[model samples]
Target: MNRKDQSLAALVAVIWGFNFVVIDWGMGDVPPLLFLAARFLAVIVPAVFLLDPPPVPWRTVAAVGVFMSLGQFGFLYVAMDAGMPPGLAGLVLQAQVGLTILLATVVLRERPTGPQMVGVALGAAGLVVVGFGRGGHVPLIALVLCLMGALMWAIGNVISRASGATGGLALTVWSALVVPIPLILLSMILDGPGALADGVAAFGWKAAVSTLYTAGLASLVGYGIFNGLLSRNTSASVVPWIMLVPPVAIGSAWLLLNEVPSTGELVGGAILVFGVLVASRTNRIRREPARQAANSVGEPNLSDPTPCTPDLPLPGTPAQPAPAVP
Candidate 1:
């Protein structure tokens, strides 16, 4: 990637890392379900007008919307409200990548390389270090919620890959449009007008800013850029950069929320990075050979679509094993 792209990617990373801070802040003012409902509502207005259609089928687009937009945020918002720390929320969310990898293997039937297998081992070990190393108690309900969010996200990744919805900003917008109806209904059924009124009455500039940042900038712009990277780059090249979010999240938590990572979290972070690198290394190596040969022949190879698809292997799916390359 060029310096400019790298800079943009870093900016997105920062936005995403800070998203937890915003989420935490918003949760204080709004109920989790209502917060998600409002956030997604904000998404619909701008997305309807500003975004273009993704290049995928409508079914694929709707699936992406359900998983990535609705389910992921729904579960995550609930998880955070249920006491999942924002800093760790970011780290645990990285588990989505691993889940995606596993799901892709099953649904897409793609096989992982040796490096990826090593990554799985390393990442699993790191989780063990993080989960059980310290005298920390993992919240079962919160962890389950996060896993649900990851599954939703993984399904979205597969749908994106299957449909080749590499339209980036346009696709993000379209996907954002998917869940307004359900969210509105959910808000009515669960939160009720009274609760929502309370939230709105209590909503200050801080809450408003957090909502806008999360829905508009973070989800919209961040995903836009992320999809751009996925569309233009290989999974090996792009997926691992996601691993950067955890440390950034930890730092953001410390700086913003004064939530410091425990010693075990630190150790787990290191392990997570190591594992992601290993899993990504094989794809990187394979791409290198092909890119070199393509360069020699004066032709660019652009076969793989965005890695942000719902086809990524996730938990709760059978291990069907995909090929090395998508």
Candidate 2:
């Protein structure tokens, strides 16, 4: 990756890292489900009307929306509300990378490479450490919910891969259309209509600002730049930058939320990050030919239509795993 694209990746990481604190602040008076609905509302609205839909089938779009948007955030927001700290939330949610690899192995019959296997094992160990360390600081139910969110994120990745949808912005906007109604309906059932109304009435400047950051900067601009880089470079080159997100998240949480991790959580998080680095690492041989060819021709090889799908985060910036989400 060039310096410019590297900077863009770093920017996305910063925006997404701080996003947890923003969400926590934003959800102050608002219920999690209602807040999530509002966040997606910001994502869809007039923007969808202006942008063209992604070329994927409607069913694929709906599937992405269900797992990526609704399922991920529904579980995530509730987990955070149940007292999972924002910084830890960012780190723990990265388990989606391992989950994605495991799922692909089973559902898609994609065997894990040696490095991927090691990465998965290390990541699982880290999660176990984090889980044991939680004790009373974070609820077990909240931890479980976060893991469920990560699993949902992994499912969305498979859907995206199966659909072969590379249209990032279009996919994000159109798929988001499937989110709000279901989330609102669920909020009505679970949180009660009274809570929904109260949340709307209590939607203050803090919440509005948070929504704008998540929907505008983190989701739209972050993913936009990320996908653009993926289009220009190899996935191997682009993916490693994502490893920066958790550190940024941890730092931002420390600065803003004053939340400190336990020694066990810290050790677990480090191990998990290392595992992800190992897992996502790819041999350069396959991409070398394309790169060399592009360099020789002084142009990009557009013939290979590899989708620029990095599962970071979309609208709500729910802690996406690897390849893509938000």
Candidate 3:
């Protein structure tokens, strides 16, 4: 990768990693759902006009927005507020990697490689280990909520891939817009206007800064840089670097929130990382043959080709304009 790309990636990793701590702080003041709504509101107000419309069909965009923005964030915030540690939240979210791979096999009908299958198993085992390690101490409802949140995130990932705009910032921004209204409505339904008013009244500069960091820096700049990387490198090559997030998140939580993982938690995290590495490496192997074929034909693609339109033929596969998303 070029130095510029590397720098941008590093910046994104830092922003995303730091987001855990910010969420922890922000949740102290605002209701989780309201906090999430406020976050998207911040993003939509300034950047929505600048972003182009989503490339996929409106239905696909809306579906993806629901999974990615509302479902994922809403559940995650509630889980954290329920006493899941910030650093642990980061680790748990990594489960989305495994879930996404599984969903791709199911929804996209892509076959999983051996390593990926093993990786998924290993990740499951790791979660089991973490669950048992916590014994009866951890809240079952909280754990279930976190896992559900991760599943929603995985669904969102597949939707992004389906939309044929997997690596685009415009899609991310558009999804942000698609999510905020529903999120606000949901917050009102669940928390009521009085909860919203109380939360807003409690909102201080720190909370505002936290929301800005989440919306502007983490959502916008972080995803922008991430999509930029995907547009430049293979997912396998770029994704391994994401492994860095858990540790960064853990360290940040340790320093800022004094939230330290137990030995069992650490072991669980290591296993999770190992599982993700295996899955990602396996997926990379699966995509390489297609990439090489594309490159040989002078239609080189930096990322994995979309699988939804197999008949249309990918750039390197043969001369065929890939069908527009239906």
Instruction: Give the RMSD in angstroms, all C-alphas superposed, for model 1.
Output: 10.1
Better-scoring candidate (lDDT), 1 or 3: 1
lDDT of 2 at 159: 64
Give the alpha-carbon lDDT of every model.
0.71, 0.72, 0.69
The Cα error of candidate 2 at residue 86, in Å, is 1.2
Writing each residue's lDDT as its tens digit, candidate 2 over 51-144 gives 9887878998899889977898899999999988887787677667666655654554445556656656776777677656545677889989
Compose the digit string of candidate 3's lDDT tens values, residues 123-241: 66776565455444547777788888889977876666655554467766777767777777877898899998898898888889899999988888876666556544534334444
Candidate 1 has its poorest 10 consecutive residues by lDDT at 282-291
> Best-fitting candidate, measured by lDDT?
2
Each prediction's RMSD to truth: 10.1, 11.5, 7.5
TM-score leader: 1
What TM-score do all the candidates reach, one by one?
A: 0.78, 0.74, 0.75
